[model samples]
Target: MNTSATLLDTLRAEVDQSLRKFLDLRRPLLADPDLAPLLQAADEFLAGGKRLRPAFCYWGWRAAGGGPDPAIVTAAASLELLQASALIHDDVMDKSDLRRGMPAAHKRFEALHERSGWHGSARRFGEGAAILLGNLLLLWSGEMWRTSGLAEEALDAAMPLHDHMRTELMCGQYLDLLEQAEGESTFEGALRVALYKSGRYSVEQPLRLGLTLAARGELPWMERLCVEYGRSVGIAFQLRDDVLGVFGDPAETGKPAGDDLREGKRTMLIARALGSATPRQAEDVRALLGDPALDEAGVARLRAIIEETGALAACEEMIKRYLDDALASLEQAPITPESRQALTGLAIAATARRT
Candidate 1:
């Protein structure tokens, strides 16, 4: 197997184990039977992810001359909890019904309410419960990071970046909401939303967190590499995600086809399409986009319009350019050869992945 693939698989297993151990340790604190379901929900939600953020963090540590240590893995795994918290809240905001091929957190809670005959409004109850669950996970993420056994100095060094990352995530999310409310967005506007909402936290900040932890502080070269490499890959990763949100296979992505269309996400792809669309094509988009009752036919029409307008091709080109820029930046990074190779592999995987 490829070394990067092997490393990613190993990291995934280790992260999963770390998460399980952390959750087990916390079980006693929330031991009330009434909260059993909440714990179970957390477990289930944490079970399915690519573990990419943790991998990026681990490799960033390695790139900064950090030696192999289990403590770093534990610390990196805490990112998964943060990711889960964000995803749970994101699903509620989008009013999405499915996540990872299963009912979304809110939907599950709503069903629980209905099944028990215990709520005035199952929908409201579900949304409330899911929100609380997301908050709990966010709290646990901080606790896990603090207690991951890394040296106090290292944790302290990285703390500011950690706080900033979460703040940026919230800001990005609010920008996304504002964009949706405004109905249409320019390519630049959509790109800004992508960078802040998903790109920064997903790749750059995680890598920075790891690098800072390992170095006990930031260096000029480290900052340069992260900006040149990490930022480019992060943007490309989000662009690919925009493509997948519309065109990816359901089985692979674990979401309904054209879910982005249904949600009316004002992604860069949509912006590009609208920028060049004919009057009738634009009219069709306005009519069908965000329709809760959108069907496969509507999805197909929108897909066709996106393709005919060359938006899809333009987006693909942009992804390629950004990915190339990232890979190019890696050639001169003063990191270990093994880490250099691994980072190269990670860059490709992030932008080229189907899911």
Candidate 2:
């Protein structure tokens, strides 16, 4: 019997090899040599993330009575491609300088433009190229899913879920952009964004899709329970991210301290803190929350206010509550014991992570 860590370690290895093999096949086919940088960007960016989506997808299959099938692993890895596309596009929209401790795709391309002595506006060229690269990755994700070598019956069973996952992902991105532009959010409004963006496509849909692919036929009741389980874990995951964004160690998170505060993320942590802060504290937050030039002193001040007002503790409580609910449902999920252990481990790690 595989240990829980062993199971995930093996799956992660399989997913990595699959990503490299898929990228290698495409590397030789790009007609223009200059376009090579985009491939490198995708490869490196793909290499750095935690592989959470693929893990969820693979476990979903296991929970549905599926055995150890490498084909399902290959299919699950495709979600990473979709994830890459979303992240690259987000970097562009946010004008972020770094991703996963490296230059953002747009900035990378801009540097390449400068090194090549390419003409025209470097900024425009870089951003335009990055956008197209994101589009290319998006297309390749669909290709990967379509050609994953699963049975046609299984593919058909999972295709609608895949379609919805993609739709929700894009819609979530748009909603995030709109939310940021709107300069504020209500608690309910922020939850709506989390539902579609981080919660649905990232966890719930992928889990359900994997289950559907291996199912003998429709199992609506099982699917509904899985959704409930996935949604709860997924939301907790996002909320934990918000807490880490404010209070995590910079080394563990691979970003500068208070990077979210610097970026003015307007996360639930910030919203809740403001909602509960004393009048003086609220005034301090409003003056500094979105200031790009906010320094260590300013970030520390805001963090203090957040903790003093109980927002940080409140978010932690919510994560624990949601995690408990998810685990409770997972215990009664009709899945095998091994699958239950794996799912429970994933939920805990995803929520308890520092990064």
Candidate 3:
């Protein structure tokens, strides 16, 4: 394998090990037998992921002249916990039944309630438990970062960025809900949702956090690189995700086909489709877009509309443009040669992934 690929694999392994160790240490603190199920749910939820955020953080540190260090790995792994919290909460908000091809946290709890013959409404119990689980994971993320064993000065320097990342994530999620509530959205509106909801947190912030931690403070060029390169790559990543939401195989995406359509996500693809659609096509989309009971036929029809309207091609072109911008920014970045290459590989992987 090439150097960048090898390093990425190694970084993933290290982060996984760090997560396992951290969870094991925390296990004793949650010693109650009743908490076993919650802990197990967390474990299952966390067991799968691309670990992209942590990889970005690690490579950002390396770019800033930081060397291999277990402390950094531990710090990077904390982002995974933050990611987990987001996904768990998001699944509940969307009322999604599956995640990573397994029953979603709420569904798992709902089934548990049913099996136990609980008196309360199973759905209510499930949603409440899942929300609590998400909150717990969010809290744990902060705890893990604070205790990552990095130097006091470094940790303090990075804390503000971390705080800002979490704050932005919540705001973005709210914006997403607001967009759905408002019904159809403009292309600009959809792009705004994508930028804040997933892009900034997924790439820019993680890169900035690592750079800040390694530099012990923000450098002048760091912000520029993050904005120019990180932001572009992040947006492209989310764009690819929007495509996968409709076109990806269930086996690869771990969700039912066209789940995004069922959930009525106001993605840029949808915005573009609506923009270019005929009256009949627009009517069909509006009718079938958000129906929870959308069957394969409905999905197929919607997919055809999206394709015929050229939305899929438009989104693909946008992804390419963003990726080009990101890679161009990297070419002029005054970082390590190895990091530039690795970041290039990461950018490609993020934008080109099937899941």
Candidate 4:
């Protein structure tokens, strides 16, 4: 029941090892000239991360009074694979130029085609390859979970939650895509989309899955408490990301300073700013928010407007409120003291992170 920082570090190491082992076994299955790159892509993508999902899952297990189990680490690592799949697909969809400080999965594949002097459209090849790779990662996530060697009973009890997590992630992704096209999204809609896309999957379900596996059945109280904590904190996590999207240092964020603005995401910040703006101000934001050719000056203008319109202040306030709620919920939760403390630290780290 020791959920210390060291324990988190240990879990991260174990998860990384488990991921490497899985990749080693799976790589041979695709042992071919054409498919070598797929394994390489997965390996590279999996190299580094915050390991948030698995951390939540592992801590949930601990919170349920479960003892340490290596199989759990192997199974929890599946979340990382799921994350990879989502990122790859999302980058492709967004046509994002960078990921984790490197060329995006699709762009890398595209570069491969160009270097090889392959025929046909390089962009298409890159996009197609990245999509297939993402699909492979998704399948591998399930495989890792299924073969993690957690007791069959635990696996069976947890399988439904696992499936639903994936479905919810996709559901959220669709909502995000929908918001972009549907113009003038409301604050409520943006918040809803954030939860659907990343909030739940990021914190709640992973914790719930861990608890479910430990209990080997449903726990009504645990579920109820986790939902509140995850919803509040999870939404805040995305909001923090939105804040970083605009104001984070590039070196810290591993992306350009103004990528979110360039993408014109209808995030809560944008929605709030628009909601509170004068007609001229709103019109100016609309002109520069998503302009692909937006220069440094334009980004500065938008940032100033966001700050001046009180949207930046409002988003920060919302994040603080949600984070406070999440921490308070954990205080009264029926879990181990160690877990509560670990989760408290995790709450701050996830929401207050610079990257």
For residues 1-355, could you state the per-residue lDDT of candidate 2 as single tens digits?
A: 8787787888899999998888888887885877678777788888988788999988988888889887888899999999999988988887777777788889888998898898998888889888988999999998888888889999987887788889888898888777777878467767777777898777787788888888945675666656679999989988887788789887777566787777777777877887898999989988887677889999999999999999898888888998999988887778889988888878888888674
RMSD of each: 1.1, 1.6, 1.1, 1.4
* Distance from true location, Cα of 145 in model 3, Å: 0.4
Per-residue lDDT of model 4, residues 1-355, tens digit only? 6556766777789999999999999777989888888888889999978899998998888888778888998989999999999999999988888888888999999999999999999999999999999999999899999999899999999999999999999999988888887876599999998888989999989999999999998776797667778778888999999899888888887778899888878899999999998898899998898787889999998888889999999999999999998888888888877788888878888899584
- Candidate 3, 165: how far from true, in Å? 0.4
- lDDT tens readout by residue for model 1, 221-335: 9988888899999999999999999999999888999999999999998999999999999999989988878999999999999999999999999999999999899998999
**Model 1 misplaced stretches (Cα beyond 4 Å):** 353-355
Q: Which residue pairs in candidate 1 collide?
A: none
Off by over 4 Å in 3: 353-355
| Best of the two (1, 4) by TM-score | 1
Q: lDDT: which candidate is best?
A: 3
**Number of clashing residue pairs, candidate 2:** 0
Each model's lDDT comes to 0.92, 0.84, 0.93, 0.88
Angstrom error of the Cα, residue 128, model 4: value is: 0.6
Q: Tell me which of candidates 2 and 4 scores higher on TM-score.
A: 4
TM-score of each: 0.98, 0.95, 0.98, 0.97
